[model samples]
Target: MIRRLAAFARPFSAWLAASAALRVLHLALGIAILTVAARALAAGADAVATAGTIVVLAAAKGTAHYGEQYLGHRVAFTVLARLRTDFFDALARQAPGVLHRHRSGDLAARATADVNRVEVFYAHTIAPALAAVVVALGSAGYLAAAAHPALAVISLAGAAVSGLAVPLLGRRPVRQAARRRQETRGLIAAHVADTVGGLRDLALLGAAGRWERRLGALEERAAGDTRALAARLAIRRAANTAVLAATVSAVAVAGACLWRDGQLDRQSWWAAIAVTLAMAPALTAVEAFAGESGTTVAAARRIFEIIDVPRPRVPPPPAPAPPGPSGSAPPRPAPPARAATTGPATTTGPTIIGPTIIGPTVIGPTVTGAASPAAAERRAAAVSARGVGFAYPGSPPVLAGVDLDLPPGSTTAVLGATGSGKSSLGYLLAAVLTPTHGTITLDGADLRDLPEDLIRRRVALADQRPFVFSDTIAGNLRLADPGADEDLLWHVLETVDLAEAVRALPGRLRTRLAEHGADLSGGELQRLSLAQALLRRPALLICDEVTGQLDAATEARLLDRLRRDSAGRTTVWITHRPATLRAVDQVVVLDAGRVTTPAGPRLSRAGAARPGLSPAGSPGPASLGDTPGPRGPAG
Candidate 1:
């Protein structure tokens, strides 16, 4: 895992090398100052000369120290920024599917707090560890040449004990404590997010006290982990101090014995002591950073866990077959001519793929000429599911062997009670969740084979509970269409019947919403989410109980608008409400993860029934007034 993290710093290798070199230079200067002063004192050299030499070395040491700090932090912050980008990109590749399996607060903690913790490894650990090794060895070798070989042996032993053995021995317990603390922190963040997001509901249900107690328990666990980590760190510090004191005293006593035995001169004795003391700073630094390693390693593991999850790689669409192996491209066939009255209108402005619908409300718009290739594909995207099946990990299957077809420009209603897989089916059709069995297709091409951007652009799903960022109303709506003007924003809002309510606000489009749109009522929040989705003008719009929060009158109005403006668009309404089926052209019932057609009059296209549409069961022209659903009748 440490090796993997080092790869992220590859782009900043030059900075790292410079930082490490400066650090080594700084420590070397400190050792030089000590050696110079010790030898001068033993020889009774000129005071002026010794002081001058020491002062110059100290000045140089300070400069190197500054440079090392600057470069170390530069590399750390830059690498951190890159890590965040890569983390988000990885999450996006596996999104909706992967997102469902993780807590939002835990994900947020990994991205923010966990990533921040890894900064210690880059800023303090790497270069200091490198410099410590270089300085320790240099000091030992110099002592051997300038003093007795026995003195060098004694110095090396002390350096090794203080720098290597003590640190390595204590690392395991420190790391275990750090890991526990990090996990507890993630849980606390998750609980806080859940509590805050559902605070209104909790208050209404009088569960706030229960939530508070749970939070208190998590805080207690986090506090316990923190205390354990602090205790281990305190013990390690005491051990390092003890080792340092013992090593210095042993070196001094050994040098004194050598001098007394006439095996060392006074100058040689002082030089040996100076070199031995020089090893202290480097070895002590190694010990200090070792304590920090436990926390850094734990945080890094958390970050990599998310990045390493398996994500589907959607290949780019195949190039246009290499121009058919000719010098010039082959002549393209012209589209078939249609009756003048039946032909769709053309526009010089932006090509609208289909009518814009928010939730179950629609804002009318028609396609135009000079369309991009992607736009042309979106104009008539037919979808089909063949024996689709899905199940969450460690849970029973949510959907199974379901077959359904949504013809271009058609509206279908999927009616099922809670836990009947209506939302799961919608997710599969919208390409947010991949089917574990069989296939789902868009325009005869398998959805799994298509690029993510193409799927996102052509299909839009207005979730029953959509996320709203803490931003102005216009800002939230602009997420779907950043270039949408005030006129367009108001138009979509009006279509969803949210314009009047918004206008009554003090800031109107500029009004800032609380996190999760906490300030707004449920119906307003849903309409705002719907308006945002409508800005995409997708060919296929999937609404998963988007109108569930609205009253019957508002739901009726929204559905009426959807029926009027949903021309030339494929719409799927996922709801348990039977009255909502009035605006749909056909209805399919999902029960126990299976799709079966109900015995009712179904709307027919051009007064004709589609054959071979199995899994949809018997086809018929359903009367608009009939109340059809899973409990109404069986095929």
Candidate 2:
């Protein structure tokens, strides 16, 4: 934890240095005030003279302290904000790999609860801890200047105890407290998120009351942990206070003895009192360090765990990508889809290789009846993955050994039972999950060796039960293409057959899609997901069981559009039903995580074979069963 904390702070050394300087100035002002007060008291000073000096000293010290607070907090908060940014961005980029291994609530706890704990260390603990040392040394110097050099040693000993000893004594208990708090918070988040996500399931089963009782018990455990920590915290405070009182009493007795022996003067006598008073604030400040000590440890461990997550192999930079016509290639395997290997590769000036440019256009020999323009366009082939394998962090291999190649300009259907690693295959081929054991390539080139941002613009997936932001349809699409014009946006909407529905809405392009898209029907939500995938215009499109709940007609319409728009593109559709598979060019079957042979059907020239059933005795091809039905995975 400390190592990671050091790493977070490493980038802001300048701010730390400035904060330290302010702390020194602030301490100096405080010491000056203490010295003036002691001198006035020791010299049989006049009431008015003493009052004036003390007031001026208090004002100067207070201003310095205020400046120190502002500067230290500002710098710490800025660093903390940056740390939060780094943490969140890294988590976003890292989530694809980590999600399979971790629970959503657990991750949230780390990102939010754990990161917030570091603030205490930055805002309160660090500067004062350093300032405590400076004040102790400065007080000793002040005492030495006042006639008793030995008193400086006495002050140093007390400051050292408060700065170092107190925290060390509390370390074990504090660490345990922090770990308990962190773990409890994660458990609570996990339970709550699980309950909320599966609300429909619980309600349907009449298990809602049971789940609440269960989650209530977990919440009580978390609260109990807090109570336990508070109890220990109080004990630590008592111990620290007792030691402080003892130290002060001993010092006072020593001062009196020194004065009796004539070794200490009136100045030394009064200085002792002022120095001892400073010890209380300095000692009270140490408690902050002890308190946050546990949280910092927890946060550091959480952060380190995230950083250790494995990332997909980054693809090499595209070789000075060719600037094809329109700087956009057709969705076929050779050109536009190569961009999907990483994403759409961008080129500034005219070049040789471009993502959007349609590869060499073939002119077929024309008989009296040649292929229609739409058929010929649909004939454009897209990229395919031959063999893929993957495994989550703790689980056994997800895709043990799977071999399948997706054809260009065709929708390929994949089916399997739950936990058979169906979704894992979609993510792997889409470059969202890097195969641990096998290679995945686009246009016959390895995907891991491609630039990532380029992949997002070219290859994309709409997940099962997709999330919709509380924003307009246009706002949602803008996330895919930030500069998407209203015309292009509407065209994509119409392409997905949502134009009628979108137009009927009160605000149309400006209408808000309420949170979770609760207002939209399952069919509309599925179509909306389709519209999103269309907006990307990706060379390769991955739909992971996203259409498992719509009515047959709606499903048919959506699948038909998917097939139509798939022209010049490669499409992979994960499903359990055989009906949807009938429209696609080929079908891949996964059983226990391995691919079966003889790609199901070649729907290119001929129509769907064997009605609704896939060629291999699979269920109806268009199973929208994955549409978050009664079985929401039960967490």
Candidate 3:
């Protein structure tokens, strides 16, 4: 971690060097001022010359101090900016899967507080350590040159003890305290963020008081950790101060004895005393920074933990076929032609491939020896999961051998009880989660082989509880399609039955939303999410209980609009709502990590009787067994 931090500092090497140089100059000036003042007082030197020299040295010290501070902080903040950018980029790569192992609040603290703490490594730790070395060595050399080799030895030894030995006295305890302090801080930050986000829900459940007590307990624990750390630091500071005083007093007394023995003149005696005092500042700086070193190390380790997460591998594109003999281009063989598909979509089970033409599209780079564009467009995005399985780390499998097929242009509804893997299946189909045991193919091509950006563009998933940024309605819409204009935004809003409400807002599309759409009602928030997904016009749209918060009338109207608008698009509606099931072409039921046969009656596009089902029957396969009543699906 230290080596990695050093690399980040490389970009600001020039500024750091300048700051170190200025710091050395500042210390040198202080030494010169003290020596000159001592010489003037002992010999009763010319008053005007003495005062002018003292004034000049003081001014130079002040100037160097200013330059050092300016350059040091400039380097610190610049390095911080780069560190934050890299941290966020690494976090983004691990998101939604690898990051699920960490709490959102803990991750947030890492991004903000942890990154801020790293500034000290560059600003206080590295620069000061360098300057201390220079000041210490220069002071020792000055003492030797002044005809006091004995004093020089004493000064160097004192410098070593102060810089090196003093900091090591309580190393283990100080380090432990620092780690505990930072950990407690992160916990407090995470808890506060979670409480704020769910304050309303807690209030409704009459559990707000309990949560408040929990937060207070966390805060008290953090404060206790901080106080413990402070007490340890105070002890260290007192020990360092005593060491500095003893070293300086011993050197001063040794210089006086040498002067009395006729080994040194008056000027030399005063100069030696002044030089001894000069070493105090350099030693003190090192001792003080040692305490902070523990905190810096702990913070850096936390940051690297996130950055070191392994990124998903993307396969290299296949190399073009070797040139034919004689340097002449060989005629390429025509790709296999697929039969045109029509009628209502159907599935045999979770693993069976439906009779739909799966082909690639132009959203991603076309692979060599692939089907032609015209043929690909004629085919729908046929998704199939063959023995697909997934489970969170250290947990039993949530989805096992989940074989299923989604025909092109088919509207399929996934129905299951809570914890039956409905949303997990949706994530798998949308390419958000990779199958652990089997293969998921997009148009006969392994989804993993496709570029992530291409999959995101072609497959849109509207989460049950969508996240809305604190931006205008138009701004949120632009997140799906950046170049979409006002007309396009209004069109998607109208499709989700949210146009009229938005139009009545003070600024219409431009009216800014509070954090996470706090200003909008629950139904409005869901509709807004749908509108954003609709704007993308994705090839596959996965709605994971998108209408769970809407009223029956609004839900029916939105479903009708979705069925009409997504005419040729493959729609995976992950819902248990019977009203939503009426609009889909077919329904697949899941039970305990397996795909069960649908027990609901199959309905036509008009929700009327199908050829194989009884009239007024629920729509689906018989394997689902004992479908719920016609009122609506439960949570």
Per-residue error (Å), model 1, residue 380:
2.9
Question: Best candidate, lDDT-wise?
Answer: 1
RMSD of each: 9.5, 9.3, 9.1
True-structure lDDT of candidate 2: 0.64
Candidate 2: tens digits of C-alpha lDDT, residues 314-413: 3332232233553332222322222112232232111111112111221112221222243334333345554356777666677764555555654566
Sliding window of 10 residues with minimal summed lDDT for model 3? 355-364
Rank the candidate models, highest lDDT first. Answer: 1, 3, 2
Candidate 1 Cα errors over 4 Å, as ranges: 93-100, 198-210, 312-378, 563-568, 578-582, 599-635
Q: What TM-score goes with each of the models?
A: 0.80, 0.81, 0.80
Residue 27 CA displacement from its true place in model 3, Å: 1.9
Model 3 TM-score relative to the real fold: 0.80
